[model samples]
Target: MALTDAPVAAKSAKRLRRQPLWIIYGFVFPAMAMALVFDYYPALSGLYLSMTNTMEVGIQSQFVGFSNYVQLFTSSIFLNSLWHMLVLAVVGMTIGTVVPLLVAEMIFHLMNGRWRYVYRLTFLIKMLVPGMVVVEVWGYILSVGGLLDKICHFLGLPGGSTGWLVDQHTALPAIMFIGFPWVAGVGILIYYAGLVAIDPEILDAAAVDGSGGLHRVLNVDVPLVLGQVKLIVILSAIGGFQGYFAQFLLTQGGPGWSTMVPGYYMYQSAFVNGDMGLASAVGVFLFVLIFSITLMNMKYLRSSQDYAGQR
Candidate 1:
């Protein structure tokens, strides 16, 4: 009887331990349900809609079965837009990632904490302003006889008559340069946090060994913060690929299609042309591209072990 009772008590204790886990699942279920309803449902619906010829609402649409994709692949405009997006993603990621890192390093090395906070708040305040407002303001600044033209005139340069946003040559560059002197608030904060997490004793040791300035940064500081750098790189790539608001608000794909990107192409297909099926196909392409690259990044570019191995 004692042996049987001991086994029963052990089983009871194990069941009791699982009760908290069940409660946690109960607490999390509603939020999970909401995400499925709002986010995942729309994505799945888009993929389904991509298979049909959904020209407009309240109209009978037929199943096309990959015709839209075939048309898109053969379209020169779509290929050009894709090339523009690739260029924007690479250039934007490089400048956005590097500039903020340098700024964060400058701020972190400041002797006065108060000044550091002040500079941080200054950059952060720009992010608080509406993105549309920023784009509109830049539109004005890049237009004919705007800020750049005025500066060019002051410096005795020609081409003041030409608009930056209107010229095929300058339109893309103008869009990419909107956030000039890049020092993005979020990027700076992330890099600063990475710098802060480094062991101070290691820095002190480097200093004692005569490591200074660029040497310390390149060798010790950068290696220690490679995890954050990798995270920023991956996120920047994703954002740059999906981002089209600046192009939409500023160029509207431009005097020509010089500033066109994949995101804006999708937007124009759906809203301007009212071709929902093609738009859905574009969305699917974007989803697959972003998802595939993200998975590859996670699998191959893991910063923790990669940087540790660098040592």
Candidate 2:
């Protein structure tokens, strides 16, 4: 090619590459706007508010410079709420991760395609139900003379009419029992997708080697889905630390703070007690805790091919 033609062709290629830059920015603009407005702005504002003694609106609250955080750490009520959050995180993460993996494995092994689809549809339907509706149904089930009491009546057990959400000893446990089976629908789908991604030859080799059932699951399947497990674990920990929907709906952190989780405590501080500064401080603490734990997990408990290679 001539030198002039070469330069022209190069310029044309550069223009073509630059042409799509505007389209990319156009597509990304909406998400960027949303993050700035909803996520980034609120986070920055909350952090600033946490350092002040702001309670009521329109009155200039003086900057207290970490006093809110100090109070949060020293308060017995906050400490109790932190403990409750930790327990819920542990229990929820355990059942949320393991149960869905088991369910997914069972579905993956189903011999009939129709039956497998039916099972998947059923799990999906559970997820279609709104979370608030589920909490309300559980609240009714725990109410006095509700389904629980009827079950106890069938067994001739006295004191079955006890108020589950109103008793200090039972409120937190009752909140935890809302999703009794604990096989989250989305979790099942994720694990199943991970299992489905495995090469068929790998499974055939396992079967040929006489590795099936529990032996196959522990040695082969589990390692294959470690990525899914790690994903669910991280998600569950974040949700458990931030979630208080059930506690708020069913118990309202009642029965003398027995069910007071950190999220609800923060809510009460802001909306109920008019202590926005403290609530903001709690929010900051929760953000740090989740960020730190997630970083540690990503650093040490990586979901990589090393374990799969070992297997």
Candidate 3:
């Protein structure tokens, strides 16, 4: 009887230990359900919609089976828009990732904690400003006789006579320069936090070994905070890939499609041309491209870390 009772008691304790896990899973289930309903369901719907022709007036959406995608790839305007998006994404990714990391390094090296806090707070405040407001402000800055143009005029430069946003040569470049310096609040803050979390003893040891500032940053700092770098790169890629709001507001995909991007073209297809199927196809393409690159990036990072034995 005592032997049987001992086994029963052990089983009871094991079951008790699992109760909290069950409760945790119960707590998480609802949020997962909501995400599936609101986020993933729409994505799946869009995927389905991409394969069908949803353009018929007062009729059921007919199954088109990849025809929309064929139309998209064949269209010069669509391909051009994709090229523009690719350029913007590449340029934005580089600038956005590098500038914030460099700024964060600067802030981290500040001996005065108060100044670091002040700078961080300032960037955070900038983040709170509405996106539309930022765009409008930049529009004014790029407009003729506005701040940039006036500065250019003071320097006696051409192309300042017209709004930079209206010039075929400068329009895309103007869109690219919207957030000058690109010290995005989230990027700076996240990188700064990652840097701050690094063990100061390691940095001190590096310094003791006669490592200069750049050397320390390259060998010690960057490796330690590479996870943060990866995070920022992925985020910047996503943002730049879908970035068309500035074009929508400032350029309207003009001066003559110079600023056209896939996102803007998708808007044109859906709203301007009433071609929901093509728009859905574009959405699917962007999603796939982003997802594939993100996966590849993560895989590369993981393999590199493994090879270098990063902690």
Candidate 4:
């Protein structure tokens, strides 16, 4: 009798503890509605808009199939901009991905004391400044007679008074080299977290086996932080496509489209030229490209993770 009654009371208590479905829905409804209205609606509408002949608001919109995309691929200016964007993306990703990992390794190998904290803080402080401000500052720096000018004069190299940002031959390269040394705070933080989270015994064991600094870093440190490296690479790739704010704000696609990226091209099409359909088409292309790259990166990261787990 006691056991039967105990089980009955436990079940009753569990039933009593469960909340009503309406209450859960009440908590979730607002968020779901917001997502549908703000996120999904815009995405779907943009997709629909990309296929239409919409120029601007108050203008007649008509379905025109893939004409906008055809126009985009056929335009020499757009094609040139695409080439420039590719160059920027490749250079930016290589520098942005590799440099932070190196910086993180340097900081991680430092004596785990005041110096480590100081160094970490020094890099992370870059995150304090607004991203827009950073872009603007770099824009100024790359402008005529900016910081690069002084450095060029110091090094006895010919510094163009017209600035690399405006020179047709150097505009893209200037954008590529904006963040000198590329010690991005976010990358440093992510890589450092991965490094610190590593088991100390693994590193100590490497040292015990007569593994010196370079050997340990090459074999142990880098391999352990593969996940972080993968993450930064994906982020850089996505940023490569979407991160054209600098070009938009400063260069304005100047010097005959030397620094123009697809993102900035989209903005120029939609806002400046009032070609809504064309801009939406560009947006769609960028979204697809970025999505594809992210998926590939994720797949690679997963396989690497699996391999690491096997080892």
Candidate 5:
């Protein structure tokens, strides 16, 4: 009986070995197909289009070969808009990354219960609020006759009655402030989840060793949550590069284009100016920038452990 079972066991083991390969292909194929359809094809098409002079109304195109990219550098408006995007990326990343992590860390120290629930719910609600609604709400709040202006006037600040979003000097920063809370609220939730996953014993040990409050957080909690911080930073950077909706709704990239971002520029190129070729170039540039940043982030932040080790 044992000798007969040996052959059956061998066959079963062979099938098991084959099963995983089939499963791997099965799982990978759908994702690969989706990427080819939605991501890769569009990207390749855009690269091809960038070398041509394509207009919205025309079905015909003339291959111009690098002229669109060359023209980008020569156009002062395009160059200035690109520069503005860089600045916005830096500023947005700073506010979105730093503030959320700090808030998460503070929230973590609070005894987990109703307070945590309430705070988390509040942030989630803020996230659910529409971007346009938030922008318009803040627009009213920052207007010349808005609540902030009245408060500033009461405090006797300079330009107390001024419209913050209409002033070129403050417009970009004001728009940034409006957009930031939405992004930061999401980041806070991510970090909060990360904090919850941390081993409680480690924190307890730190407290027992007389490391309390900020010292304990800076030394122990922060290091342990470095992975989460890295995630927040990379995601925030990506969001910064892609940010435009609030600025579009609120200032319309106005106050002398101070709030202009790459996304807005791409939109204008594609629709308003009807320069599909230039828009494709801008799309390609954004794709490359985002891809490079993501690669750099993964290289620096991702751990070296294999699947078994992580488990």
Candidate 6:
């Protein structure tokens, strides 16, 4: 009787395991389907399209091999656009990462809840404004005879009436500044949440050890929140590289392509010039660059965490 019951029990256990396996499959399939429909399918289609010469109005496409990529490499406009993207990536990362982290840290040290709530709400309002509206508003602010110019004039500064966006030398930086606050607000919120997650007891202990303010922040707060910083930095770098809307709406990649970025150039290639192959190649390049940077950041962050653990 015992031997017979053992086999029956084994069969029941097998059936139990199979039930949860099917449940997991049922839960995972919808997400997989959505990924294929939205992401994977488009990426695969783009890859195929990038290898062919597809005309704007024609139904026929001819295989062009890697000619599109070769042409992009030889194009001075594309090269310059790529350079502008690099500069934007560096500048945006600085503005998006550092400014927000500093602001969050300062706010974290403040004892007043009302002031913190006010600042948080202010940033939230700014973030809630439509991107197009922000771009348009800033375009006016940067224009000659606009509020910024009037303020500068009031201060008695030379070139106060100059339109920053209309100059090749300052066009990209002006657009970057317009987008900076939008990107920085997200980072600030992330850092603020991270700061709140820190243990109050740990902070008290640091204070008892005679570490005050700057020393405590540098030693205790920074290490604890390093993970959030890493996430913000990686996100900022990606946003910087892909920044397009403000530049497109405000400068139209101009004052001689000074405000041009990879996304803007890609749009011009595909839509304006009807060069879908080259545009797809540009897209692929951006994907690779962003992927590489993200991986490097992850590795460095993991290493830092390991070192902190040792200490």
Compared with the true structure, what per-residue lDDT tens digits does model 4 show for residues 1-311? 11012344555666566589999899999999999999999899999899998998988899999999999999988898888878878887788778887888888888677888898899888888887888888988888999989999999999978988889988888877777777956888788788888899998899899996778878988888888788877888788877787787788987888778888999999999999999999999999998899889878888987787798
lDDT of 2 by residue, 174-260 (tens): 788887887756889888888887889999999999999989988999987787788789889999999999877878888888989
Question: Which sequence of candidate numbers ranks them by lDDT, best first?
Answer: 2, 3, 1, 4, 6, 5
Q: What does the lDDT read for residue 53 in candidate 5?
A: 90
Which window of ten consecutive residues has the lowest lDDT sum in model 2? 1-10
What's the CA error at residue 247 for candidate 5, in Å? 2.7
Q: Which ten residues in a row have the lowest lDDT in candidate 6?
A: 1-10
Q: Model 5: runs farther than 4 Å from truth?
A: 1-35, 160-162, 179-184, 303-311
Question: How would you encode candidate 6's per-residue C-alpha lDDT over 1-311 as one tens digit per residue?
Answer: 11012345555666554466778989999999999999999898788777888857476888999888898889888899889988888887777777887788888888689888778777777777787897898898989887767877889876534598998887877777675445337777888888887889998999899998778878998888887778878988898888788766888789888888889988888888898888888888888889899899879778877876696
> Which residue pairs come into collision in candidate 5?
none
How does each model score on lDDT?
A: 0.85, 0.86, 0.85, 0.84, 0.77, 0.80
Give the poorly placed runs of model 6, Cα more than 4 Å off.
1-30, 112-118, 160-162, 179-184
TM-score of each: 0.88, 0.87, 0.86, 0.90, 0.83, 0.84
RMSD in order of candidates: 7.9, 7.4, 7.7, 7.2, 7.6, 8.1
- Model 2 residue 272 lDDT score: 94
lDDT (Cα, tens digit) per residue for candidate 1, span 7-97: 4555566655546787989999999999999999989989988888998988999999999898888988889999989989899889877
Worst 10 residues of 4 by lDDT: 1-10
Indicate which candidate wins on TM-score.
4
Error of 2 at 40 (Å): 1.5
Q: Count the backbone clashes (under 3 Å) in each candidate.
A: 0, 0, 0, 0, 0, 0
User: Which has the higher TM-score value, candidate number 3 or candidate number 5?
Assistant: 3
